[model samples]
Target chain A: MKTRKKVKQITADGFKYAFLTIMLVFAAFPLIQVVINSFKTDADVKTMPIGLPEKWVFNNYRDAWEIGGYARAYFNSFLVGGCTIVIVLTVVGLGAYALSKLHFKMRGFFTAYFFVAISLPGFLYIVPDYFFMNKIGILDTRMSLVIVYTAMQIPFNMLLLRTFLGGIPRELEEAAKIDGCNELNSLLKITVPIAKPIFLTVALLVFVNVWNEYLWSNTFIITDELKTVATRFVKFTGEYSSNMARIYTASVISILPVVLLYFIFSNKFIEGMTSGSVKG
Target chain B: MNNNLGQTALFAIMRNKKVINNMKKTSIIPYLFILPAFIIHFCIVTLPSLSTLAMSLFEWNGIGNATFIGFGNFTEIFTEDNVVKIAIINNLKWLAIFITVPIIMGFIVAIIVSRIIKGQMFFRVVYFIPYVISAAVAGKIFTAYMNPYYGINVFLDKIGLTSLGDTLWLGNPKIALYSVAFVDNWHWWGFVMVLFLGALQQVDPVLYEAARVDGANRIRELLHVSIPGIKPTIAFVLIMTVMWSFLTFDYVYVMTNGGPANSTEILATWIYKNAFAKYRAGYANALCVLQSGICLVFYFVQRYISKKGGMEDED
Candidate 1:
């Protein structure tokens, strides 16, 4: 009976491994395909799409960098994403601190307001917002994307930060107050230090969102110099439709920053993303 | 005695004034902290959203003079616009697909991974890789893989799957929406699995032990113990799935541009075309409101169902 049970357990283990391996392949195959195709020449890609290239060429990257204007796109994405992150961190950090700690009459109202704001579809206001931006003369500029991204991401970041802040001991802030530190000083000196993990999480989330944002970036920033990696990709693909290697290289170039960052900080990325859904 | 009473009144008045001043200072701090977020949000989201509502009642190109034509946009959208109808249907199709496919796939994967003793984290990170990649990148990757001449089609053809290989996945209108949705789901379900896994970790282990003691097989344990344990998470995921379905624009737009005769036109993309490409700003605003209205309906419905479910659980 013992031997029989052992055999059954072995079979179960085998099945489990098989299932997981299949799922892993399913998950990783497309990305692997992208990476592989990025290295192949156009003829190699056409003939053997899913196989190792006979002659691995590196010119695609150079071509994509120069012809596709990916370097400029990358800089634009960083500038927009970086500025948006700074604004989001400041606004959301302060707002979250107040919402989590301070006693105020409109706290409940603002909390619900953000909840609704997060759910409100962006399509609802894109047209009017576009016109508004055009009238304000910020259209075709990176600042326009930064402003919109900051507003769009605030609610989620605020709520997440609030949750994190709520978990921090109240004594820390109260003790700082007793030490004669003002509210802003207490937050900057005391709360910000302790909330570093959450701040990192929020910053990463904002960076990813702004970097990967396509629709608003596509609509608002029409200038080639101002286009982000995502919008630039659309134009790049159109320009390089027949050259599969160049297209793939540009695709890889566009995604490299995000993908690299994600791999390095996968744990924090997962935690930040799942925290709101699981806990809220 | 009168002097003493007057002095006591003066002290009381001074204390009250001081208390009022302290209250004002305390109240202002929170407002000050919250003001920056509120200002940006109002300017970008709230004000523009209000204008969208107002604009829907007028017939105007975005640049030119405006004329009020009350309910005209709505009337035209419901009756005249064939694309709106297709978009609504396509969105509904997307809703149906998302509600079932990802939830089930994510749940099953979570369960399988949860039972494993090692490398669960590896599986999780791998699965979530797609979710991190931009939708545009995901779209481009699939567009390449779905290319008729040099992609999965050729492989399928080699395997004697002639019909499958012949499919113009994105070019053909009949299956274009589904193809885009498949790519979206490929990037989506792993995130779902991770979330469910997180919820699964919080489930009480004793219940699973009890099920095992009661001679419950794996399937039975899953049905009775695991399902009930993660009910709330499942419900939340479902609600979000519906909400996101209506808002899904990136994959469809990036892949097809609602093309091949508008077969893949979800509401968001349709709204984009109407507003930007066609310059039917007023009509597009109506569609936007309609999309939001559908989302609100989904939100309330989920709230009602979850409330009912909560009460049932109490019983």
Candidate 2:
């Protein structure tokens, strides 16, 4: 009986492993297929979609880079994403600090406001936002994208940072105050240094979201030169619909920065993305 | 003696005045710190959102003079617009698929992964890799792979699965939306699994051990212990899935562009087409409002259910 039970336990373990392995493949295969196909020529991909190229041709990357105008799109994405992170961090950090630490009358109101704003769908305001941008003549510019992204990101990041700040003991800031540090000095010296983890999480989250944003960027920035990586990628595929190799290559190129960043910072990426949901 | 007393009194008053001034300065500092975020959020999000309601009531072609026709756009949406009806139906279909398929897959995978000790992190990172890639890239990858001539269709054809191989996945009106949903889910479910795994880690292992002591099998333990353990997380995921379903756009837009005669037109892409492509901004604004209304309904319903559940626990 003991041996039979032991065998059953081993079988259960085997089943678990088998299930996990299958899931891992299902999750990883399509991405692997894309990466593999990106190196093959169109003819090679056409003939063998699942296998490695007979001879790896590097020109697909070059052609995709040149014809898709990915360099400009990359630069534009960086500019917009970078500026968005800076703006969101600075603005949301201050707001979060105030909400979490300060004693104010409207704090509750503002917190609820942000909660509602975060829940509201983006499309609800997108049309009016477009008109507002056009009316101000910032349409088709990187600044418009930056401004819109900054606003869209603030509500969630602020709430996340606020929760982070709330967890920190207030005694440290009080001690800083006793040591001749003013409120701003206390925040800068005592709070900011300790809140580094949350700040990094917020920054990485904002950067990824801004980099991946498509609809607003597509709508607001119509000029080809100002187009972001995502929008540019869509247009690139449309323009080169027949060339599967270049399309796959361009898709890989567009996702390379984000994917590499994600792999390198996988822990932080997972933490930030799941922070709000898990905590809630 | 009198002169000295008066001098001390004067000094005390000066100190009090300084304290008052400092209090005022500190009070204003929080406002100043919060101002930039408030101003930007208000201008870009709050103000525009408020304006959408007014815009929906007016008839204007974006550049021309605006004319107010109260509920005219809303009337047209319900009475005249066929795309709006299709969009609403498609969004509901999306909601149904998302709430079931991803949640079930995520829950099952997460439960299994939670039991594994070795290579757990490796599986997690790999699974989540697709989620990190942009929707546009995911869309493009799937589009290429679904191409009848060169993609997975070829493999399917060789495997004697000729029906699926020959079917125009994205080109077919019946399958275009589902095809896009599948691609989106491919990138999505893994993230959901990771979330569930995180929640699963918080579950009490002692309960699982107790179940084992009671001679519970794996499936029995999962149904009784693990499912109840992650109930709150499941509820949260459900609420978010509902909200996101109404807002989904990137994959459909990039893959099919609500194509095959608008068969795949979810509300978001439909709104985009009307506002940007067809130049029907007013009608599009009404559609946006309708989408938000649906989301708000879901939000309140979730809240009500959770609250009732919480009260039951108290009882």
Candidate 3:
């Protein structure tokens, strides 16, 4: 009986390992294949999508960089992401501080408003927003994307920052006030430094969302010259349909920044993202 | 230069005021604090969203002058448009697939990842790498990988599966939506798994211990103790999945653009087509209102269920 139990344990362990290995392959195979094939020639990829090349070729990256106009795409994406980070942090920072710390008449109403706003689908407003941008003559500009993205991010990131600030002790700011710091000064000086980690987390999250944003960027920014990395990649893939190697290579380049950031700050990414889900 | 001069002057003026005046001065400070974020969100999101109601009642091309047509656009969606029905059905299918497949896959992976002591972080990060990839990039990657000529088909052909290898994964009408959903799930389930892993780690160890003491096997413990411990997270995940499924556009837009007889056209894509491609911005707003109305109904239904279930949803 004891031997039978031991046999059952081994089988269970084996099953677990089998399942995990299958999952690992499923998650990593396509990506690993893309990476491998990016280094090979187009003929080689057509022949063997998963295999290594006979003679490794690095021409795809250089060809894709020039052909895809990746320098401009990366620059535009960085500009949009940078502007969004600065705007969202300062604007939402003050708003979150108010919502969490200060007493106002419409506090509850604003909180509920933000909650409802978060659920508002982007498609609903994006149509009219398109025309509105045209009216303002901001169409085909990256700043058009910056404004839309900052607004789309405000509600959730505001609520997120509010929740983070709620945990900080009120006594810290009060002590600063007693020592002659004003209200705005107390926020900038005392509370903000203590809440720097959450702020950085919010910044990273906003930057990722901006970088990955497609619908707004696709719709509003019509010119190829102004396309962000994500939209530029779609156009690139279409233009390079006959060359899988260049298409996949461009994709790897577009995802490199976020992926590298994820490797370095995976915890912040996971925490900032899942916190919204859990709290929702 | 460091701070706004207007704000600096307001603080400077308030500093010398009496206690009663201080209270009055401070009450408006919060409003001042919230003004910048509020103004931008209001002009961009809130105004446009509320305008959809008004925009839906008009018949105007984007560049033309507006003509008021009450209830005309709404009725036309049900009567005139053929794609709206298919798009809604496709969205429902999307909801069904997302809530079931990824949720289950994520839960099971979370369980396994949570159990492993060594290399747990490795599995977690590897699984999540796809989720970090943009939809445009992920779709292109899959577009290459699923292409009949130069992708996974090559491997299948090498292994002597000619029929499977030759299949046009995104071109076939029958499987196009599912194919797109598969690419989306490739980038989605890792997120689900991470969320579930987060919820799982918060589960009490004592409950698992008690289940073990009660002679519960692993599957039994998973179904009984582990599942129940993460019930709120599961519900939250389902709610978000419902929301996201309704709003899914990036993958389909990038991969096929709702092509091949519009087999993969979901509501968002259809709405985008009407608004942009067809130049019927007014009609698109009507469709947008309809789609958002569906989401709002589901949101309320989830809220009611959570309230009825006595789920401790503090947020």
Candidate 4:
């Protein structure tokens, strides 16, 4: 009986491992294939899609960089994403802190505002938003993208930061008051330092979302030189289709930085996102 | 002198009564802090929304003044457009797959990942990496990969499995929608896994140990403890996926561009083309309003179900 059970258990474990390994391969296959394909000349990719190239070629990257204008696109993405993070964090952090920690008569009203904003679908406003941006004379500029992204991000991030703030003990603030710290001083000197982990998570999350955004980038940033990586990449593929070599190269370059950032920050990003949902 | 000073102090206090009227005045400070978010939300989110709603009452090209059309645009959308019908049907299909597949895959992956002690973080991050890539990039990559000439299609063709590459995956009207959903599953399953993983970590280990000592085995332990552990998270994820599936635009727009007889048209993309491309701003807004209403109804229904479940669990 013991021998039979041992054999069964071993077989089951083997099956489980096999299943896991298969799934992992499937999950990783596209990334691997793309990375490999990006290095191949167009003729090689067409001939042998699944296998390694006969020789490693570096010319694709050079041609793609020059033709795709990825350097300028990267700069634009950074400008848009960076400005969005800074503006959003400042506004939403202050707004979230006040909403969570302050005692005010209109707190209910502001809370309702956040809820309604969250519920409003992005499509509902895109047409009007385009018109409004035009009226304001900044329709195609990176500033428009920054402001719009910041606006949508604020409600979600504020709600997240509010939950984090609410978890911190009120006694800390009272203690700070006894030590002659005003509200702003207490928030800056004490709360901000302790909330660094959550803040970083929020900042990174916002940055990634802004960077990965496509629709708004497409609609808002029309100037070719000013387009972000996401929107520019689509146009690059379309314009450079005959030069399939360069499109693959551009695709690889576009994803590399973001992928690296994600791998590095996945831990905090996952925690921050899940915690926001649970606690808030 | 005492009477004069006392009377002046009483008057001063009385004059500031409006400011001191509220007992929870300190609570007002939170609202003050929340004001900046509100202002920006107004300008960026709310104001545009109202204008969109107003525009739905008019017929106009973006360049010219919008002509007052009232419900004409809405009528035209529901009555005239075959593509809108296709879009709604495709959206329903998306909603169904969106809810079922991710939650199932996420749960299964979470279960597997939980049992593995080594390389858990590495596996988790690798799964989620795709989620961070923009839909445009993913669309491009997948379009190439699924291309009949050079993509996964040709690989299948080479191994006497040309039947698998028989259909134009994105170009075939019958199978195009499913192709989009399949790609979406790839982009999304990892995210759902993260939610499950978070819930899984919070599960009490003692329960599992107890199950083991009782000879409950792996399957039994998963059925009893793991399922219950992540029940709420699953529900939340399901609701969120439903919402997102309805709002899906970027993927469909980039991948199929609603091609091959509009097989892959979904609500968000349809609305986008109508308002922006077709220059029917009013009709598009009407579609948006309808979509929002459906979404709101689902949101509340999910909330109610979760609340009731919470009560049951508490009991």
| lDDT per residue as tens, model 3, A111-180 | 8888888877888789888998999799898889999999999999999999999999876886787688
Write candidate 4's Cα lDDT for A1-280 as tens digits: 9999999978866776776677677677888878887788898887777878777799998888878888899999898888988888788778877777666667778877786666567887888888778877999898899888988888778888888888887668657855877667778887888888888888888888887888888988889999999898999888877655566778889888878887788787777656534211
lDDT per residue for candidate 2 within A90-147, as digits (tens), equals: 9998999889887666789888888877776788888988887888899989998999
> For residues B167-271, what per-residue lDDT tens digits would candidate 1 score against the true structure?
999999999889999999999999999999998999999999999999999899988998889887787787788788888888998999999898898899988
Candidate achieving the largest TM-score:
1
> What is the C-alpha local distance difference test score of candidate 1?
0.87
Q: List ranges where model 4 is wrong by over 4 Å.
A: A1-8, A276-280, B1-31, B210-217, B300-315
> Which is better, 1 or 4, measured by TM-score?
1
The candidates, ranked best first by lDDT, are 1, 3, 2, 4
TM-score of chain A of each: 0.97, 0.96, 0.95, 0.93
lDDT of 2 by residue, B1-315 (tens): 999999999987975675456556688888877889989999989998888888989887776788899999999999998988899899999999998999889988998889888888988898888788888878888998989788889888878998888989898999889999999999899989999999899989899999999999989998888878877777778778888888898999989989989999989999998889887888888888998888888877876786676512331
Cα RMSDs, all models: 5.3, 5.5, 6.2, 6.2
DockQ of 1: 0.63
Q: Encode model 3's per-residue lDDT on B1-315: one tens digit a residue.
A: 657988888776665354346446688888998989989999999899888879999997877898999999999999988988999999999999998998889989899888876777888888888888888788888988888777888889889999998889998999988999998988889889988898889999999999999999989999888888888888788788877778888899888889889888999889898989999999999998999889878877877887787654565
Question: Which segments of model 2 are wrong by more than 4 Å?
Answer: A277-280, B1-25, B302-315
Residue-level lDDT tens digits of model 1 in A1-280: 9999999998998899899899899899888888888899998887767768898888888988999888888899999999999999999999999999887899999998888787777888899999888887888988889899999998888999998899999768767866888889989999999999889988998898888888899999888988999999988887778888888888889889988999999999999887655211
